[model samples]
Target: MPKCMIDGKEVEFTAGENLVKVAKRAGVEIPVFCYHPGLSVVAQCRMCYVEVEKMPKLQTACSTMATEGMVVKTNSENVKKGRAGTMEFLLLNHPLDCPICDKAGECDLQDNSYGYGSAYMRGSEERRTYVDVNMGPVIQKNMNRCIHCTRCIRFGDEIAGIHEMVAIKRGNDIDITTIDGKTLQTEYAGNYSDICPTGSLTLKDFRFKKRAWMLKKTTTVCEGCSKGCNMEIQHEGDVIYRCVPLENLDVNRYWMCDEGRFNYQHTQDPTRIIEPKVKAEGGWKTISWEDGILGIKEEIDGQKPTFLVGSDLTQEELTHIKEYIALQHPGATIQHFGTPGLTSTQQDGALDQILRMKSKTSNLNGAEKLGIAPLMNDTIKADTVVVMSAGRAKLPKINAKRVIAVGVYLEGDASQFDMILPGLAFSEKDGTIVNHQGIEQKLKRAVLPRGKCKSLSEVLMLLTNKKARVGANP
Candidate 1:
């Protein structure tokens, strides 16, 4: 490791590490706008001004690589003046809409301006503004808030492998918009909101939703696919507001696909079955947990029910299901099902060069590791069928006389089921899932189980209990 001095403090750095990274490691903060670790550094913002001992002028820390015996001053008078000038220029056209902006608390511009910007303005001319362009469903375009960091533009070309977003003009009049003002054509469009320094690009799903500081964050992995991109579930009062990518350099880096980013919406959907329900003559009727457990037992009590375990389930949940099936129904056919037509790990691979995976479920490899075979031809061959899922895997076709669904389900998903035992979503459960790379990650519980939802362990306990405590107050 090479050594450097940042603000009079000695610091160690690896070869080729930038000053912005090395300075931060030494507890010295260098403000930045266009210096996302995951993206290429352009030094376009010119905000990370640092004074090198021998250099004549201030240098942008993002593009300045640290070298042996290099001495960098981050908070000198000249550096502060340079950074303050840069901050003033950036805030020249940026609207004072922090109160209404979705990126208020988390905006890098807000934090940098308060720390480095001048309180008074010198320019008397009218501030430049542009008509907001439509960037399609995932992102809301607000050109008025852009500072031309070009993070979104680089992300599209380098990360998403799509050159959709582009800068049409140069200098202060530059505008970052999709090509021909077209709708975004990338499956990873949600990342545009994550990498943007300001509120220029914000998530449409999170617009006007909740204040960033008000929501609690839960670090978890995406169960949407086998990629297992790390993400944070932002929620308030047990209600999820949004999901954002958490940087894991090994797995998802700093980006997550729109499918994983907006996947939490299904958990909070209005028609999701939160309470235990039994299919009646007229329609579905709400039942207590005790009754729901007994109802499931009644359906497949003496029969060898075929257990269709979803590969989306966590290793803990799937292991429990396998053990429960073995004790409850010996010699019963049990198979794991996720994406239809994609059975084994051999069929699971990268959907794109990016983070998306072909296997829609998170634990396809884990299921295969547990000795559970994939459902053959996506078909079931039994009189009684029990389907267990965490609501990520596609539901397989069932031709059985009695069908029981035990997991999260929406109203439309219950049409062919005899009974529904509500279970926790990935956001409400703590368990482990193995990714496509064979790296195991833990899913942290962000909220309590919604309504009458119970864990698979609890449901299994009730079914296996010899002392039939039926109708005994849920």
Candidate 2:
């Protein structure tokens, strides 16, 4: 219960806590560029300067520890002038092309410049620029907007555990590049753009797609794996534009792996099977929702079934499937399948030293928690197999006489199934999923189900109740 005076207000902070956190409690703003809560505090940006009562000069709030009984002045003339000077210096060589930059609306450098910097320039010298290098397929580099904050450098070293990004030179000529201009090698490379205070690094997938201000954001969880890294899905016109990590200290912290970051791609894939289809004399024929349910009932009618639930499904969906099986198909066999070659949570381990897990599915632990056993190769003897999942789980090869797939899937994924009932993806449904650590997280609905896709619960209702209406939002 240590107390410190920030501005004029007494703020209590944990001993050894930095002034930035303490200032935040007292509603005092200390601008920072190099300091990320998840990364090491380098205090190199010098943008979060504050005037201490007994100290002669300003101190960097990001690195300064708050001592009990110490007074701080974040808005004093000395601190304001110090911050303005830092802003001016940072903007000295920064490109003034905010009109076209993708980071225009959300760029920290732009906001700081307008808030703390003087309107008139102190120097009319030529600005610095460098030829951009291709970091990789995930990131696009623009050295002209680089602020030399070293955030990406520190993130790669301290968090990612990969020392791939480095500064090649010193001072004004310093070029932040990979070793020998090699392409980015880390699987977490998408985070390079997320942690950048400026648009020096931007995601290639999100580049030029939409302005940062134009998209609507939905707080959600990543369905890529069991990590369940919190994320935000941004969209406009009911179309998802991008996904970014949401901070969860106990889980993903301030970062998400590239696999989870780009997992939204499949949801918006053009080749996805959006309409219900029934196999007939032809390869596959588009069928109405009513007819689709009728066809499924006819196929599974009077035949013993082996239900293969995808471990990628949320806990709510999994529980619903369990209840449905118990009530409707009492003698039917129900098992879970996901992440080929990986069955039980016992076989699941870290794919890397960091976030990636060996099991590709998000709810393998949840499925196990529900007393659902892993499906084995020998369990494919039933006359009909009903496969269900949101999307991340890969379908196992089925040799059953009749195969009924009831989940979001792509046309290319149609090779192993006989009938398809279009279902919602992770972003299109609201449910709960337990992660590898047994922490239950919520998967929020970002957009309505794309095309004719329906929720799994609704599909089950349609299958069970002849009176239930079947529609996209149902």
Taking the tens digit of each residue's C-alpha lDDT, what string does model 1 give over 1-474? 779998889999999999999999999889999999998999989999999989998899999999999999988899989999999888888778999999999999999999999888787768788987788898999999999889999999999999999998887788888899899999999889988889989999989979999999999999999999999999998899999999999999888999998899888787889888888989989998778877777777777888888899999998998888888899999998989899988988889999899999999999999999889776676788888888888887788888888765454558868888888889988999999999999999998877777777777778888665634222
Which candidate comes out best when scored by TM-score? 2
What lDDT tens digits, residue by residue, belong to model 2 across residues 163-210?
A: 999998898899999988989989999899998999999999999999
Reference-based TM-score of each model: 0.97, 0.97
Q: What is the lDDT of residue 227 in candidate 2?
A: 83
Residue 382, model 2: lDDT of 61
Candidate 2 pairs with clashing backbones: none
The residue ranges of model 2 lying beyond 4 angstroms of the native Cα positions read 467-474
lDDT of each: 0.88, 0.87
Q: How accurate is candidate 2 locally (lDDT)?
A: 0.87
Model 1 scores a TM of: 0.97
Worst 10 residues of 2 by lDDT: 465-474
